[model samples]
Target: MNRKTLALSAVIGLLAPVLAGCGGSDGGSGGEAIVVGTTDQYIATDEAIAPLDPAAAYDTGSWNVLRQTIQTLMHVPRGGGKPIPDAASKCAFTDRANESYRCTLREGLKFAGGDPITADDVKYSFERVLKINDPSGVAGLLTNIDTMESDGAREIVFHLKTPDATFPYKLSTPPAGIVSKKDYEPTKLRKGFDVSGSGPYTFKAEVKGDTVTKATFTKNADYTGELNVQNNKVELQPFTDADEMGKALDSGDIDVMTRAMTPEQVESMVEKPKEGIQLTEMPGLEIRYLGFDTDAPTVKEKAVRQAMAYTIDRGDLVTKVYGSVAEPLYSLIPSSIATHTNSFFNKYGDRNLTKAADLLQTAGIATPVKLSLNYTTDHYGEATAKEFETLKDQLNSSKLFEVSIKGTEWKSFRPNQIKGDYSVYGMGWFPDFPDPDSYIAPFLDKDNFLNTPYNNAKLRGELIPQSRREADRSAATNTFSQIQDIVADDVPVLPLWQGKQYVASRDDIAGVEWAVNSSAELLLWELRRGPGAS
Candidate 1:
């Protein structure tokens, strides 16, 4: 679930407008309330449950709310360090094989409403995710767990079907956020936006129909966790348009704006910001690409898919669609990850019209091969329309492919794509964690997120498992490199551009750099009003 479930760095832009002095209505010190604006929205209906529910939500917006409202056994440290304890007093692997793990909770932990948090709550939280198995949920991240057993009220042990060194990192994510067994149903998603957990904050949302318009968070006095709460209160306001969000930040309606902004907006702010405004830029791991259902009739031919890859011009996309805000990605794994390689570049080099024609000609396929490309109209951003149009233009220029593009809203787009309704669809991946396994396993494994008919025996059955067994993750670089090579050969998915992260806030806002982790979960507790803030 990145905004796909998303990741996080900093360049600062100081704007020139004369703001109403530091002593305004909001207050004059660090205790003032904070309002954070975002373009990310949370949608729930009878068809889709409230994303704030830990068992059902998988996207970034939902995860952000869950992060502040619930606590996990472990959490990734700021600036990309190893996961440290959060709910638990301590956690460790008990077996040399890395198959058995255990945790001991802190004494006298309580939820926001004074409910005691026991080992059973932790067990219930995880088992419900597996039991509900929501189509759009993060259940895929917990597939490695085989069983769990509780030792008294504080200790919980987990047994895995196979070795998984990345399990600790997975636990730090949203899916493992401990929920109260008394409040959350075992098999059904909770009906509304109210959340009760032992996190640093207690949450309440104002909903209009199926949409959450305003989300409020107050420091949870009854909670126990590793995070040091900074602000006494935080409010989240969601907007459908980036420009509108930018305007809110400009008018001082919101204190901090993050999660997403159009590249053009970022470039404009970087060049000439309004007075009293500051913008920060950081390295992001969000990758957008084209996914092909290998069994779909239109894109079933391997040569056709390869020719489409050769026909795409990533540079053109960077220039026309994203400007200078994004980098052209050659591999599925972004450069921020360790084992990244330019396998696609090494093989295809550049967009070659001749090689594209040759590939199709050699396969005895007819020229102007007709294909339909599908993209989501709302999910990614406004640039997505232009991005896909650029893709269609590139493929049409090669004359080896005829492409018709269609756009759908995310509500129908995700489920339809999973059902294999589209031949080739545009999608994005935000890593579940900071490791290479988050990038590779979700796409290439037998039960991949794309729902494509792809299962490379060598890569999936051997290399992936072998890499997970290594306690030292850096030692598995070669294995990940091999996996990238295999993916480039298969061409089931075509790599597009990877984006950068941007957060715009008032100069008086503090902790913008530490508000988000490498894995992209928003840590609201890190935010506060700086000295001289209004």
Candidate 2:
């Protein structure tokens, strides 16, 4: 099946409406402005959004905003799947071993503030992200880079420590977004809401009560990129609650709702068909999993981790907690990606109590092992409580374990998880870039974002490094296969389920289906208020 076919199959029989380009009651060819609603208040809440400076903005909300305002050397094209030149006229590996990369800037390139974009700007942008080196920042993605050199005003070259074919893909992310040295401080982070960028949109933000309540994005006439703005003006609004956002969508307060809408919300909208609202489902690379801190007394034993993985019923978790909105995942890499392998499923076919028991016996573990599982309530969704409860019930049913469940908000949860306060915890990953390496490297690296005590030399030293050198993604499948087998054996983390992306908008919105871009950032430029839209 083709990509579109595969994406449609995950929508649970709502494929026809999405594929037919169905619009809401108030439908038109699209010319009016739009208000996009999101339950993702990370930017508004100030709890997750770090410094908005391109170098320090690592969270999803900050990146979503930056991706629109700042132009990167290359970007995942709108609706198209591959990375393509955005700020650069062209970009490619210059060396035979893929250690060097070069890009030539588009002529007459200028920032929104009218500063000339040059090779110097490109070099400064990358070096600054590395220089700031915020612990939470995404500079780690550029660790392979040895140095950057400017050929002239228009061309820049990158030298690498080792052969890395995925370097260009890393540059396409927000951390590599080119910034004007004339506007931003080279060493210190740029503060305040004022942003200087060169992309499809010029952002003007409004901060109210420590949250970005509204962001007004105007078209950048100076932008020299692939994005063609359909709507002249777009306003992004944040809601503290999904129900509030849902009401706004139904009341025509917002033209579209993009992120953090729970499965229950989507199902409610689909079943009742809210008068003017329609749902568009896209293929998502979001994977939810359980991480085991190998240093934790309860899970230090590999058998305990394997038993937890073998005992939980993924089918029931998806059906009961996720309501079929998500599919059970068996690999760290989402199945949609080319390098994915169902190693976990192959190793442990189903929830076999006998097998879990045998594994525990082999490791000399006593029965009724005490386990503490931690999760965040506000971060994931309201359903997360039920999800953990269901998981606790499953493990307790095995009669070999006693589980304690703890819940906290994301603000406290993140720092505590990083401090290794949780014995076992749940994590949901939205990829930094669409690659198998993004899944493997960040999660297993010695100083992983999760801060779990997980270490596999073969995976960290050999398989991942070997896979990074393969220019052809398909040829690296063997390396990814080995990585997955190792992940299954180590049992540091258990793959749970992968979610399907859902965007709900009023029927009059014409481009709702295309709102989610290849990098999984919601493109507000794609949305337009249709002819009869409220």
Candidate 3:
């Protein structure tokens, strides 16, 4: 069995914890409010705008909060599947080509603040995303939308610029979250931590300076949606690091832990089970990757990038650094997604010193290619620094590269990445939705999310658009394979490892597995106290 399978198989016997620990505190009318601790900080700065506003929020950190507070027309179901109705009563593509889609608002839906939700609000919410077009926002995802029209208060229709089969999946994301037209302005972002939506929860955050220290979610009495809210309230606390978050869980300061926990912490929990803690493992779509600034001086040459790809050993990094918590990824499209290809492995196989030397020698580049690798310090996890050090050792051992490592916090690192300041940098990706297009389009397209100067004409201009034309996604496998093959040849980005999602929580808390979705958004309503608590 593979590492992921073993992790899941071992979980069956190890999850038996019987302890009457301190249950959640009473949440007035909503009953006991379950508290969840997370290391995923809600970041907003002059450099990168946090997803406090649905129009400006794009990253997973912001989406986690938005998914709970803001109601989208549709949402992905729990335990992994396609999206179903949430706010909308029914929705379907009006045209056979997938160019036109329509949704009918569910009856009697209203925002948390007592404003009625309507089709006009949905239209305004999407239009603002296109109008503001924040550099850090998810505006790129809405480019296909040519025009949207709302007929009265109950119905809305979308006309797409192209036949995009992935449009529904995009609707299931945080960017598509329906906002109150009354509360949010048309041209600018709606600032502050207060959220007004028609989802299952009404959110209020405690902000110290710019960071959100704590947030509370009260069950929305006005909510009319598919989710069956089990609890009256839920509290969220954001920690700066995983260790601090784990400590909070252990001390009963928090009831559940999600988003991230270091490999060492997970291994320790498995080897010696803690008294009241239960670890639940789920399939993760998050992938760590290295992106290069092709215009930069050091790694501008394609051969230099190719040589580095051949030298680094993903197995060694997973074994030594991650310790069976992660699996080696050879494709930009992870194994969890459909039509994934192992083009990188097929071309380069495992690490080969001879291949690295020949690529450099043929290009007339001298030995020991000097490189400075950049990474974000606080964003990914605690294991990142160690992961880079292991990479440095692997490249140096090949005798064809000399490397130096630098770490910057996410706020500073993001702007520098946008400006192409670093020759090579590391970043992690969590899919906006569960689709192969989400993996390919954001990196390979002309207007890429990375803002790096590595857009390939064939992949961007031809393959991507062709694949989108197919209404049945499985029919686009050949096009996806070709795209992956070209990506392997170009060597612009290198896939490192794919992570396995884990949620460690107190045994008293139920629905740990269902708390987080396949897209990595935390569903606060899924969490509830187990039977016989308090």
Candidate 4:
């Protein structure tokens, strides 16, 4: 098992108290039933749920609910690890080249509504997601699929356009969660929040008082999967801001809180321990960086890019702006993962103002290179303003560069960025999956997720494809290491920092520590009241 997998296994082991029925008994005589409180900022937005139908649900809030309420062929084990069989009895690549894959469904599988789950449903699920092809949906991840066919009553086969070792991992995500053909429309998305899924929980979403502030889930007794639900019910509360969520947590209105906490709030919680509150600091795979528009006149020069990379002090940015909630990232791949390489640090070393100035001078560039730095205020956090200001101060201090910082809300910023409206801009990524490919492939590929055009033929055409062919993920480390080195030299983007995952919960919650799943989604099934609770 990898470091992430091991960490998840450890978390699962810590749930012994919850699994042993310590808090499952009646409140009067034995103990109180566990109640989990979670916050979703995405749902709090105006366009609530983008689309609740699995075919169109791509946002984080919708995914969080879908992952629990729906069943996929494979799933990440509790406490964050490798993908194992869930709906399928066993799944593996049929071909030696890793192109063809197959999955055999487990016997006697049924949805929460008691509808039988069969290979036909599995085939329909993948086809429906592809046919709809919602731009916001994650169907792009399934582009490698050439065809999906049901082999028999229990077996399903996938024919891929390319050899993608990560395909199985993708199936464990919400995009691949199987939906009944009988319940869903084949061409269009099913409207409303009602769902018929076969996962551990039965989910019901509603917009209370004309706004989607809350979604509740009940444990499905008919669930035929690996996970054992510890709580009878889980409630997801959407807050407009972190302050509201923090207040709710403090007042015991919520048993647990995850995501949307500002860096300062996290630091405060860490500095002063709250009475009966516990925090779990897990390794995060999220990365924030500055992407450069290659076509932009200001940053078109390679030397200018290298100069910016060498001049900025990442160490200072982490300490002063982030309050040490994040660590300076040397590579696009986060340091927590095995494939990460300190390529930038190796090439540029610590902050060297003179070296940066000399590089620009040698390239015949004039002094005080003017560049506009664009960032999104609403998306990243209020601290993002401070982060960019610190960057401006750091670069301006060198006297070799003049910086102009601008901010916009995420909704406006994304489209403008994609249209190549910004010279140098800030962007953060949350991985779709845990694999190293999630970091490198999305950024470096020809049709990258970034608004800026960054196509490295070597990294995109060869290294990534080669790495995907390797069945053992560790063996692909060499390919990723080389890709990082190329990124350092090219300087298409300057990695700022990689964050650490933190979850705050009441100390009475024993299983709260293991709430996060392998995909980094918080699993309410793992949370239950600990010993000596009210």
**Where is the poorest 10-residue window by lDDT in model 2?**
1-10
| Candidates in descending lDDT order | 3, 1, 2, 4
lDDT (Cα, tens digit) per residue for candidate 2, span 193-264 = 667789889988888755577888888988987677787888888787788988887677887887778888
Give the local distance difference test score of model 3: 0.81
Candidate order, TM-score descending: 1, 3, 2, 4
State, as a TM-score between 0 and 1, how close model 4 is to the true structure: 0.86
Task: Compose the digit string of candidate 4's lDDT tens values, residues 28-114.
Answer: 111343444444443223333345677766545567788888888887775456778988989999999899999999988998878
State each candidate's clash count: 9, 3, 2, 2
- What are the candidates' C-alpha RMSDs? 4.1, 3.7, 4.5, 4.5
> In model 3, how large is the Cα lDDT of residue 281?
72
lDDT of candidate 1? 0.80
Taking all chains together, each candidate's TM-score versus the true structure is 0.93, 0.91, 0.92, 0.86
lDDT values, one for every candidate = 0.80, 0.78, 0.81, 0.75
Location of the lowest summed lDDT over 10 successive residues in candidate 1: 2-11
Give the CA lDDT, 0 to 100, for residue 210 in model 4: 38
Clash pairs (backbone) in predicted model 4: 8-79, 80-518
Cα lDDT for residue 404, candidate 4:
88
**Judged by lDDT relative to the true structure, which candidate is superior, 1 or 2?**
1
